[model samples]
Target: MTQSPASPLPSPEERRRLREAASLTQAQVAARVGVSRETVRAWENGRTTPRGQRREAYAHLLASLAEETAEETAEETAEKSAQQSAQESTEETEAQNATGGRDMTVGQGARERADTAVRTAVPAADPTEVEAPPPEARAERPLSPAQAFDALYAFCAPALVRQTYLLTGRRELARESVERAFELAWQRWPEVACDPDPAGWVRATAYDFALSPWHRFRPRYRHPEPPPSNASDRALLNVLLELTPPQRRALLLYDGVGLDLPETAAETEATTPATANRLLNARAAVAARLPDLSDPTELHYRLVELASTERLRAAKPAVVRDGSERRARFWTRAAIAFTVALIGTTALTLRTAPTQYEPPVPPGETVLGVPPRVAPGPLSEKEQKLRAKLRAQMQHGPERLAPQPE
Candidate 1:
């Protein structure tokens, strides 16, 4: 028996054309196809191909949709030609889809990393933080490492700098934090690229760096930079800085950067409930001081506007790469020096070590045989007379001996 060949499915372009022609949204297509909208978008944009069950379901959906679109197109052909309304209708639907896509806010791919981490750790998702991306996979060629890094930096750096600035009320710190994060990203490009969300990785690094307490100790950042020229912005920043770092981070990630509660939690390394509390407390604090920012939406817009007060430009890709390499080299040299010093110290210790042990001297003590002293007795009479005679006469021993000899 011969095996039956599987039925053919439409091309990616055909798939997209059919959907557009039918005025179907990606979310609608995804729902019918048993997948997420991103997955459907990826497929339509030809970034990936559906597989196994998803592939089968997608193929069927496309085939059915294609047949329907064909019939509709034929019926509408005369009317469309007469009114030249086909293009207009397609354009309107495309515009609608574009608007819908923009609503996803900050690439979910990156937010898959954190409240907008690296997507600033990552770029942020503040609906107001960064502009919504257009359709994914508009290009056929995969981005080179350099290209990808540059593209990500250009798209997310400014927004992240803004987000980081809001997180930490220092302009220099905000810029440095972002640059350092990108430098780290460049160093770990392989891991970052392979990560599910590269932007989030960079963003998380940026956020963590920005929120670090160590930054304040740095001489350069020990003092606060000049606040925004606008008194309102300056006051708002001061109010934001007043919140504890955790609370401040939660607020910035959630309200300022547009990261959802869960993403904020992940980025901030807190539980969902804790994150929610932080948000509430932070929001309340801001509202008490600045009533205009009571609403999260308003707060987000305000944060964006405040960020515009300071223009943050990230280091170029080449500069970041160089900095990363320099750091790597410095660490490498430090490690080598440490190892060498340890070896030398060990060698010196071995060389100077004592070869033999000597016992300590014993304490002195009295001798058992030593005689004891007694009081002197009176001299004998004869001895006394001799002594008195010797004392009275001055006698020379040599003269006396010579006289005796003569």
Candidate 2:
């Protein structure tokens, strides 16, 4: 059976086309459809769709638009016939008109089937629900980048914080890890937003940040935090923290986060066997500490329970975004300042440094012009005479203890 006409809307691209081809603006369509301009914009962007009376009205408006542009866009319509579900109905209507049976204009025909004018809409096929487009398709949507970032942060932050808490057993570390990850995401938003797994991107980033061994050097994260109040909870947290960082992360990703082994390995940057070994070791440690949590499923639930018992709250998206922007600005200014300083230092050195090389003075050499000393025999006679005169003048204050050279 064909679904109700109100259930489906046109593809976001074609919805905008139908309105524009009819020479109508979004505001005009929105006004006619009794919705806000943003609602109409969202509908056209595939961010959201209209519903209830608004759905009927929006569908009716689109039908009227198609009829107005039916002739002008006949070629476009023909090209899209294979892609559309209503081609048979459209051809039959035109045929009836030509045969003089149930003759009616495009608008009249649309009124008869206004609810189902554009059945090519893939996202809003169910009137009661709107399926999200694939990440690839979402990346192409021309919505505000900030809005998309905020939406993603809001959806993933809280859960991520809890998960990180399980990984590290510290509430502050978990919160900081998530915030820092988002900050990094915002800094490189172009890459992150276009990624096939934006959530995975953020998740991997958070995991890396949370599991960093360097965090142990920070004074804040160095001290052990107070464990959960309950004995079992504290014991479980202790066991988790006791595991090696890799083991802890692997266990958390595979069991606690419900990721498969391959995914856990990829995220942890390890081979499948290594990740499996880490999980096994981590599970063994936890089970040894608390035998009741030996089962992987039970361990997952316990990890969840332990994480929830802690008061882990992520900062608001605005706070995160503002901090990210602030950090980026600070680093930019720092880089510029450092560059200027380096240039000034180089200029100072250039100004003070010697322009010409001056050869060093040579060491003194022995002189060749000095007179030679007299021979010992001639010097002995003069020395004896001098010594006798000196002894006479000195009056021999004390007898010479030993004979002089004379």
Candidate 3:
């Protein structure tokens, strides 16, 4: 038996045209097809292709609608051609009567009238037919804070965790980083929501948290082995581990996280030039380690995909206790004031206290002495004669003293 040929897949343009011609919204088609509007948009934008059963259903739907639109278009074209012919004939007769059967000018006047009739008879083209508005333009209103948070979380949390994992190389640490980052975002939704790149802010915050040393002391889940197919990735990861912290962070932020050089520098707390240098050095080092890898983008993407295997199911909502912040601030200020007052009071007391002095003890009243010494009495006649002899020798040369000694 011969195998049946496969049905042709509808092109993106065909899908869009059929939808438009069917007067159906993306939401309507998505509802009928059991997919999200975003999925339908992806198909129309050529970002993704519907596969398996959905593809067949989608093709059949479009083909049926396309056939109906073609039939309708044919009927409309035939009706318009008939009306134009009738109007042209009527105008030619009127022109001939107005020109009094003047052949030369009658033909020209009839032609002008017929053209004007056709222009006036046909309605202006529908704007939707001219060009469909973008998907974002169709939004009824801006998303509420809660809705915005949910959307942003759904879109960004997994990638944030993945980037964090790449930064920290631990699953639980990555989850903590992502949770803490989202917690902060929830606490300050107004600011984060208004930020130009809210997702970037979250990713940067998570990556920074992951790199913090504090996580080392926190409880962590067991690390999973790298996927079996990514053996070379393990080698690349080893090379990355060997790099200095700043170099590794810069490389990961630039390539793995898909941040620009300046943004990466801001997150890493380095200047743009310095960040660029780190990236350059890191790339060179990785290249040296993996000589067989020429282009590292694929490797970077693979690592990111591997890290993103685990998804964050839900974000923990931030909790704020009423008046807690106010109370804390109050206590902080009170403590500071009390400390200052205590220091000031101590200083003032020290300065105002009088110094005690001890009066000098009477010289005659020594603590352990028996009595004062009395002056010596005059020397005897022999002592006086000896003194006079000594004085005579002093007045003479030292030779007189030396003879006395001999």
Worst 10 residues of 1 by lDDT: 114-123
Clashing pairs in 3: none
TM-score between candidate 1 and the true structure: 0.59
In order, candidate lDDTs are 0.78, 0.81, 0.73
Q: Where is model 1 more than 4 Å wrong at Cα? A: 1-144, 360-406
Please, what are the lDDT tens digits per residue for candidate 3 over residues 1-406? Answer: 9955555767888889889888798879988887666568768878667777777777778888889999999978966885778676777767787778667566666667666666665656877788877774586887877778877877887667766666656566777778777776776778998885687778778777777766456554334434325576567667776888788889887777655565677778889889999989988887788876446677576667656554534343322212324455787899999999999999999998878876888675555666666799999999999999999988856853344453
TM-score of 3: 0.46
In model 3, which range of ten residues has the least summed lDDT?
Answer: 316-325
Q: What are the runs in model 3 whose C-alpha is more than 4 Å off?
A: 1-135, 219-230, 308-406
Rank order by lDDT, top first? Answer: 2, 1, 3
Write model 1 residue lDDT over 241-341, tens digit each, in one string.
Answer: 89998998888777766555666777678889999998899899999999988887888888888888787777777787788889989999999999999
The RMSD of every model to the true structure, in order and in angstroms, is 21.1, 15.3, 17.5
Model 2 off-target regions past 4 Å?
1-141, 368-406
